[model samples]
Target chain A: MKPRVALKYLGLTPFAIYVVIFLAIPTILAVGTGLFTADGSFTTENLLGLFAPTVLGTFLSSFWVSAVTAIVGAIIGALVCYAMLGTRTEGALRSIVDSASSVLAQFGGVMLAFAFIAAIGNQGLITVWLQDAFGVNIFENGVWLYQVPGLLPVYLYFQVPLMVITFMPALQGLKPQWAEANATLGGTQLSYWVRIAIPVLAPSFLGSLLLLFANAFSSYATAAALISQGAQIVPLQIRSALVSETVLGRENMAGALALGMVVVMVVVMWGYSALQTRTSRWQR
Target chain B: MTKQTVAQRIGAEPGRITRWVILVVVGLVFAIPIVSMIEFSLSSNNGHGYTLDHWTGLLSPESARTYRTLFQGIGNSFLLAAVTVAIVLVVLLPTMILVHIQFPRLRRVLEFICIIPITVPAIVLVVGLAPVYGIVVRVFGGSIWTLAFAYGITVLPYAYRAIQANLDAVPVITLSEAARSLGASWPVILWRVLLPNLRRGVLAAAFISVAVVLGEFTIASLLNRVNLQTALLQAGQSDPWVAVIFALLALAFAFVLLLIIGRLGSVSRNRSAQ
Candidate 1:
């Protein structure tokens, strides 16, 4: 009532202007460019082309790898978080674990590939051990664990720690007294966790897994970096479409492929959100 | 009853055993790669014999040059993050203030806009930015500055989340109004009242910016910047030992940042409790 100037300043002046310019514009361009041909023609060709068996195989492989990683990560994270609970440790150990977790959590993509290579490549430290001690030949025999199965372990390098960091807080949030209460009622560790801990942790656990899934799905550089150039996930495919030298190759199709990836992401995220909303009710 | 007795026995023993087995397996999975890194770092390039060569190499004059190059990368990262944080603070603080002070109706919309970055993959952002950067650099005579602009957008998620969380924590309307009613100017209110209350958020934001800027790979890799990460990649390609050393160094850097953030968080919580 006192000053119309202040209201005008707050409503549409600075904040809205910045949002429309930087955030809105860039994001709009990303989506819109992905939906159209380079020459500006509208086409569903890119999206439709994803249905090719080779492309579909790439998507499925990545999906399967991510799902396996999520499950393995969740189990590992839950176990570590549970063990660390109610345990006394020196400050150094805690610091070390925390540091390890931090590095592992952020350890991803291309850089991660390099780390793994140094550890297990043909000239790698472990490669020598595997060859000499165990009479195993990774190079000649072509180990599945270092190829198709290899990607999962690499993904888990980040995923496991991610699972730990994400779940640690929620795991800690559960009342210690609740466990004690169950024990007093003559319930065993099994029954106590089954009845109490799992229920408490379900939301955080699911949410963390959803995040990991999305993260693994969108990841391009990790698979491309660790595995050979032949690896073909959706993000890698999209990347190739954008950057490939052959100009005649489908640039518009690439945009459409990128758009298709986003749409799949949206669907998965929406499904996860709806599931989260349903399961979160149990926490209360 | 009899049913209850059977259920209890089956449930208890298996669960405890399962938990222990699961913990050991997972722990090994996480621990093995790290062990491999250390093992590789400790051994010499020529043979499997133990040597402190890698650690010693990191301390030599040539090593100092590498560190200098790394530091330069760190410096560029700091500049990018600092500038981004400053710009975000300048933009976000008032927007936060306006939301609390004048236009509560638009707060949700504002918040949604801020969070849009989290979902946008860095690679996608880089590719989308290619045409823009080409135009900006070739046409407008800006090279790395355009990269910084892109980096600012990339880091928006981290800083925005921290600032937003801080904004949610403090008494925004009361502080702003109190400052305003006392004839304090907008900038003064923001600097004195708002910024002080936002110390924790600012610290968190700074930590996040440092972590993100230091470790960011996609954009820097795509653009082929001589940033530390890309340099490490180049070094790795040229020399495996150098790659191993850089990996160890990276681990050290990550650990230190996490420790600082952890301590800051604990300190802030203690202060708030007091």
Candidate 2:
């Protein structure tokens, strides 16, 4: 190669090596292990195991949890974003909310779960207060705090803020001119949103929703902390397979489950990128 | 603007109240749990009244073993964050600037590679890193600090985006050309000229890396390494209130870090505006 060309390639060497060691090779092993047997010969047994009733059930439940959180989070978050948009962009409230959203979005995992337990767990302050003050038992129905039913709200703590962060830029990208133009043409507020605003924001909104789904789907720490036992979601299932001493030879099963998660997230990310590009075109 | 007044005449002002109301409601929804955590952490174990025992216990010598792991995890997480941020800046800033300057066509490829981790969940990344961890342990020995290498990869997507935004904002090519013509070497230009201009982005990236490393649980826990979050988890299993205290502390730490970054960002913006 020419000296200049060689220099350019040399610039890439450190990053390339880092990615290869930490990302590329490990990913290869993850997928590769799933295709081989205990003897190391290639087989599809682990992949097939992903479809067994228990494994499939975990995937389905995980999907349900992700789907519910995504939809609920998107609606609430979009409303929050819309409210913030009505304020001056550089105002204190807007900046505070924006920064808070950024922090809260990353503020998941064990601490988040602990926060929920402290709030609404069986002995949580709110639960105790409600019982003592109003004679209402928060757990009279059952102890849902540690189950999938309870995870929905806990997940939303981060999810709503995350949605706000991702969706705000798109919301800001919307030009006031579009709405003004609609008004000038004798369109009503309802008509403007129905015909123009919703259609314009659809791709970005859908993209953000998919991102939320994938976010909740792959999340493990909060779920792991809350559930404590059994594989309620795909991540927990992977955790069990990896950590459970009794599950002696299930490392490949963990790979298979990991593969399943990758496939779902890959699809979600593809759609997110496609929508992002579409939104950017108009904004630019 | 004219149309905005016309629309307001038709009563868009109602939305102003609705907006405030919605903001208040959303704010409460977000605040309740955090408030509860604080309240629970301070309350007596019997739930009859309040005390600071949990907070004090974290510091008391009686809980030395618990606090030892917690402190070690916190220290390790900070070390990892510093190292990871350094690695990100050292490796990414130059390569990104070089790519933007010399190989514009390679920008997409670089971005794609950085974003690969987004789709690869941490759980999955742990799976992939399992065998790699074996090699890493063998060569480097198993110190929780080596987790920084994995963290550097995980933080790539965010760091790259932050640095890319900074690179795009500054006239890197023009600045470098001007500096070169002034007899500055490449390292001098990068360190003295380019980096100063990219300070906001670098800080943002570092803040994100720190937040991520501090909050990271799965990789550390699964790897049997005692980082802050994992230590909190183990502590929570024994005494839940103590865990909540640590959780609140960590959250406050991240909140303060973000607030500082936010302040710096706006200060820089104001300076540039002037």
Candidate 3:
């Protein structure tokens, strides 16, 4: 009613229109299409197809990759953060580490996959060097570099850095006074970490891990670049269903897979937010 | 204090040694793959010895044809990045300032909207964008640059948080009132005073937008647009060495860009403090 209030509302108009057009409508289409038939009548076949062995296998493998990367990344990244704790915050070493972590954490997709391939693929530098110098063969068993097992290490390249960035704040929130108090109370280092530090940091750690899992689960380009054939992950499956010329018409199937991914991500992110709030309480 | 001496005795010797070891080990693990990329890129395909062949081969006529797509992809991505950054700044900066100044209660809703993209995975976003893109193409004549509209959304969460941090650090109301009292119009207050103060945040947001655009693959590839990442992946199929070389160069470029932005951010912070 008032011009001042109307102007305030007007400030939000452009972004609201953009969001509704690009984000909100499309997302609704993705979820809504999954519940319908190709003829435009309502049907549950697309959703039901989600439980087929092939589709379910892709989901399981994706979950396995995400979970492994999340757990390992959390432990290693937290350790690195602890090591960082011993350094001066304003020191050159700390700044370099922080900056590198920030850049590398966001570094994924095609280039990242190529980097790993260059380092460890069949004709990679490391593989060739090992054969030349030591008569050892990395492919002695099989060429696993492009397989799901090999993806573990490649995923960690980004995941560990992400863990460092996310987990470092919680680590810094820990006050030295608590450690001093524990020592004064006749507690050993192990007991201090076990009884005090771990409990305080648990929510933050779990939150970071969940974030990492969601990140890895949703990633597509690296896997697509490395594994040329087969839809090994959910993302690849969606890609095949959408673009593979031979498949003809699986558009709704892609929608179904996307809906499944959305559900998982929504749950993971909600939990992450809850844990974030819990962690912030103690932090403040 | 007794606690001080005890902490010194307990943590001073072994703790320092253990900490350094962990730092060094972690650093090496992170650095090795990058080091290996450089080494592999330089080595001869026959494994005889190191050579500049891969670098020189990029100039060959055959390589030129192959590189056309890669170069085009790079150009398109750069253009998209620029447009996305421009759109984000134009749309978000004014809205953020207005909300902070006149309607603080709407801050939560703005934050919630921006953060929703993070929860919606890129693949799902692509799925949603597919049918919409069909209509967009039919209407807009299917230009590659239309991808910027989707990309602007993807960068929303990062750009919003960066600008919000800058906003949170300054007293927007106080600054505006002082300028108004000095007879400065809203445009002058925003452009001269607020914009300069928010330069660091703007730079950070722009850097992130560029990096994300360069690295993004899922949406572009799914939508049938040949962007940098997709082109590189396709190039890897025919000539792996050249592709790897480009990948290394792009990664280094992004790293340098981010490092420069970080330096600029801290320099501006120090200047303000002084």
Best by TM-score: 2
Give the distance in Å from residue A112's predicted Cα in candidate 3 to where it truly belongs.
0.9
The order of the candidates by DockQ, greatest first, is 2, 3, 1
> Candidate 1: which pairs clash?
none
lDDT of 1 by residue, B1-274 (tens): 2233232343422244454575567667666666777777777767658898878887788876766655566566657666666666666666666676677887777766665665667666565666666665786475344455666566666677777777776788888888889999977987889889888777777776667766776777666665666666666666666666676776677677767866666666566667
Docking class of 1: acceptable
Clashes in candidate 3: how many? 0
Candidate 3 per-residue lDDT over residues B2-68, each given as its tens digit: 2333444544212666678998998987887898888878888777789999999988889767688
Error of 1 at A90 (Å): 12
Q: What global local distance difference test value does model 2 have? A: 0.85
True contacts kept of each: 0.26, 0.76, 0.67
Q: What is the DockQ for all candidates, taken in turn?
A: 0.32, 0.68, 0.62
TM-score of each model's B chain? 0.81, 0.92, 0.91
Q: Which is the better candidate, 2 or 3, if ranked by DockQ?
A: 2
Candidate 1 residue spans exceeding 4 A from truth: A1-22, A87-99, A138-140, A143-148, A180-188, A245-248, A272-284, B1-29, B48-78, B138-140
TM-score winner between candidates 1 and 3: 3
Question: What digit string (tens of lDDT, one per residue) describes model 1 on residues A249-275?
Answer: 555545555556566667666666666
Residue A64 in model 3: lDDT: 98
After superposing candidate 3 on the true structure, give the runs of residues whose Cα lies further than 4 Å from its correct spot: A133-135, A245-251, B1-8, B11-14, B59-66, B264-274
* CA shift of B40, model 3, Å: 1.8
Candidate 1's C-alpha lDDT? 0.67
